[model samples]
Target: MNTRKILYQFGYRRCADQDRPSPARHPVIVVGAGPVGLCTAIDLAQRGVSVVLLDDADRIGEGSRGICYAKRTLEILDRLGVAKPCLEKGVTWKLGKVFQRDDQLYAFDLLPEDGHKMPAFINLQQYYLEHALVERAAELPHLDIRWRNKVIGLKRRNDGVTLTVETPEGSYDLDADWVVAADGARSALRGMLGLDFRGEVFEDRFLIADVKMKGDFPPERWFWFDPPFHDGRSALLHKQPDDVWRIDLQLGPDADAKAEQAPERVIPRIRQMLGHDAFTLEWVSVYTFQCRRLERFAHGRVVFAGDAAHQVSPFGARGANSGIQDAENLAWKLALVIRGEAPESLIETYDAERSAAADENIGHSTRSTDFIAPRSAQELRFRDAVLALARHAPFAKRMVNSGRLSMPSTYETPLSTPDADEWSGSVRLGAPLPDAPMRNGHDQTVWLLEALDGEETLIHVPNGGTPPAGRRVLVIGHDLIDQDGFFARRFDATPGSTYLIRPDQHLAARWRHTTPEAIERASRRLKGLDGEHA
Candidate 1:
C-alpha cells in the first residue's frame, strides 16, 4: 500500500481557511502539528487555555519516524487522554537482545518487576501516534488547529509575540501571548529567529526501512553489531502494528543515500536477512545522526520543544520521548503564567529543567553513536572485546551500551521541594510519581497516577491524624485506599507522612509529619511565590 494512502486513511483532512478576520491575539500559538506540537496544544487546551496550532503540511508524518515511545512518555500521553488508543495500536515490549555477528551476547529486561502500569517501551509508527493526537485535539473546544498554515515570519515583543501565517488563500498576522516552536529538526521558525544548535554531528549515516510482511518475529527489540547478513556495521529490528517492521541499517558516511534506498538495492538486502521471505517495502529514508540542541529552550516570549529544542540520534529513541516530556513540563507552567496564577519567572524553570534533560539525552545518544559506529580502529577493537566478554562475564555485560534506552530525567531545581527527612525508596522528590495500584473510595481498582487529574494532590497515610483542608488540593486518603500496600512499599510511606504532589504528578515535597501551613508554603514555592524557594 502507498504511504500517502495509509496517511489518508488515518484521517488527515485539509482544514478550511478562515474567511473571517484573524483574531487580534491568542493565548498560545503552537507551530508545527507534529506529535510535540499537537501534544502541547492538547495539554494547554485541557488546562483551560486557548491554543492555536499551525502546521505547514495538511497531513500527518510521512514515514514511521521515532517509532519507540518510553513508559514515562506513555504516562504523559495518558494524562493527555490519548494513551489508550496508542497502547491498543502499538507493540509493547520490555525485553531486548544484543548480538555480535549472529551470536547472542546478552539480553536485558527493562522492567523485570511487575506492578507498573505501563511497559518499558511501545513501537508504533509516528504517523499513527500523531493522527491519534490530532483526533483528540479535535474533541477540545479551546484548541484551533489550522492545516496548510505556514509561519512565514515572527517578531518577539516584550509582552507578546506576533507571527505572520500564510494560508492557501492569503497571509494574515497573529499576535500570541506565547509561542511554542515544535517545527522539528530543520525548524523554519528557529531559522527565522536566528537560532542554531551547538553540538557534534557524527560522520555516519543510517538507512531506515519500514517493511510489511507476514512473519512471526516477537515483539522484542533485536539489535546487532556487525551482523553477518548485512554489511560489517550495526543493525536494529523492531515490530510495529499492521504486520510492518522497522529495520535500521548502518551506512557509512561515504555511502550513496539515494542508491541505498533504491528497490534494486534494498530488496536484495531484505532477502539476505529474511532468507527469501515474501515482503514489501513500505517506506525508506537515509539520514545522518546529530546530537545537538539550542542554547536555551525559552527565548523571551517564544519557546521551543521537541526536535526544535533538541535533536538526538535514533539509537536510544530519545527524540520523541523527550519531546513529549518537554510538552508535559512546559504545559502547566505556561498555563499558570498565561492565566496570571504564577509569575513570569516560573517559565524560566522550563528552561532549567528541560535543558538539563536535553543534555542528558545528548550525552547518552552521543555515546551510543560512538559505540555503534566507532571512528578509530582501536575503539572498534575495544568494543569488540567488550562484546566478546559480555557473552559469559556478567560484569562486562553491564558495560555494553546498545543505546541506553530512554528514561525520565530528574529535575533538581528550586521548583522541587526537597525532602526534610531521609527516604528509602526509588521515588525521589524531584522525580515523577511512580505508578502503583490502588483502590478508590468506590472500591474500584485504579492506578495511583489515575487519581492525579491534572491537579495538585496532598497524600496522607492516615495514622489517627486529621487531614489538612484546602480549596483545590485533593486529599487522597479520603477517596483512595491502598489495599495492596504497593504505594507504601514503593513510596516508603509511613504513618503521619505527608507528600505534596504537583499538577504534573511529580513529587514536590515530602515530610515525616507536616501541617497545612507547611504544605501551603511548599505549594507557593512550587509556583515561584516564596522568596527563599525561588
Candidate 2:
C-alpha cells in the first residue's frame, strides 16, 4: 500500500495571447478559480452569461482546509450540479462533543429535526470540493476557467473594468463588463484597488494537521479545552473522507509557527492524542485567526466575494460557507443586470445583502474565537465554569460555543417583499426556500428544491390556476404531490397561499391569496424596478 499523498492538479491552458489582436470583452470576468469564483462563473454560464475565470494557481487547495460544510452550502452546490458527488465523498456528522480537561462536558446535535433534504454538516477536504466545482464548470461551454492566469492590475472604467492578467506566455489585457474578485483572503486584486479590510486579528495561533490514521474514533466533531495530553490549550478533532482526520491544536500567540510544524514536535503531540497509534502526517499549517471584512463588497463595476470580500476565524467554518453564499447571492443578480432584465441598481443590493452577511459571519466567528481562547484568567475561569455546568445543566449546554457553526444568512433587504398575510412556518420572506419531498407529474419522488431548477418561480400550494403571463408557476398539488404533508407543514401553506421565489431560491414574498397584479408588482420590486413600468 502506498502512503504517499496524491495531489490533483487541473492543468493550465494558455488562453491569453499578447500577440493576438485586441481581446474580446467578456460579460463577466471572475478572478480566482477557487470554489467561490468557480461557482459564480458556473452559475452565470448556466444562466447564459459568458464568463472568464482567472486563477494564479493551476491546482486546487493543497491541504484538507475548510473541512466542514454547512447544509446551505450543500444546497447551493446542488444547484450547481456538484452536490451529489460532494455528498458521496464527504463525511456527514451532526453530533458534536465538548470536553474540559479530559472530562466530557456535553454533547449536542446540530439538526434535531428532519424533513430537510440535506444534513446539517459534512466534513470534506477543500481540495475534493474544489475538484467537484472545477468538473462542473468544465461542463458549461460559456465558462472559461484559465488557470495560472494572475491579475496584476485592474482599473474600474465607466462602462466596464480592465484587468492586466499575467500568463505563462506573457501578460495580456482583458476587459469585462463586470469583475468579481473571489480570490483568497490575500487578494491581489483587492490590493490593486487600494482597498482596506478592517477588523480584529486575534493574537492566538493554531496548528492544523491532517493525519491519515485508522482509528475507532466515531465520525463526529470533538473539541477539548485544555486536554491532559496538551496541557492548557484546546484541540479539535474532525473525521474527513479517505480515513484522514483533521486535528487543530491551539498554540499561544508567542509560539513559533515553524518549530510547531516540525515533525519532531507535531509527532509527539499526535502520539499523545492517539496513544502511539500508527498514523501518517499528510499536511500541516499554522495560521492566525482574523475577523475582517471590506467596508463594501461592491466597488463600482468590480465586486468581491468569498475571502476577497470577508474573512473570519476558522473555528465556525464560516469562511468558505459564507463565501459560497456570497457567490450564490451575487451570481443571479449579476446575470439579471447583464441581461437587462433588471436595473443596474439591483447590483447595489448585492453589496447591501452580502455585506450584512459578512458582518454576521464575522460576529459569530469573533464570539466563537473569544470563547475558545479566552482573553484573561477571569474569562478562562468563566469558560471553565460554563463547561463544568454544561455537564448536567441544560441551560449551560446552550452557552457552550465550541463554535456556533455556520448557518445561511437571511437577507433583510429591499428585494424581499414582506409577508402580506400571516404565515406559521420558519421559512419566511428573505429566507432560502425550504426543501420538502414531493412527487412530480411523472409520479416520481422529487424535492421541491429540485423543481425550482434555478428559475424564478411562484409555487402555489394545493394547486392554483395559471399565473400571470411570463411567470413560471409550479402548482404544488397539480404538478406535484405533497408527499408526507412535509411541503404544506414546512412552508405553512394555506389552501390559496402563493409563494414568490427568486432565481437564487430565496423567498421573495408570500400571500394567503394574491392576484397576478400583486405578484407582478412584488416581482418587479424584487428586481429593484419601480413604478407602473415595473
Cα-based TM-score, every candidate: 0.96, 0.96
Q: Which residue pairs show backbone clashes in model 2?
A: none
What's the TM for model 2? 0.96
Off by over 4 Å in 1: 1-6, 9-23, 471-477, 532-534
Q: Candidates' lDDT values, in order?
A: 0.87, 0.87
lDDT of 2 at 94: 93
RMSD of candidate 1 to the true fold?
2.2
Top-scoring candidate (TM-score): 2
N/CA/C clash count, model 2: 0
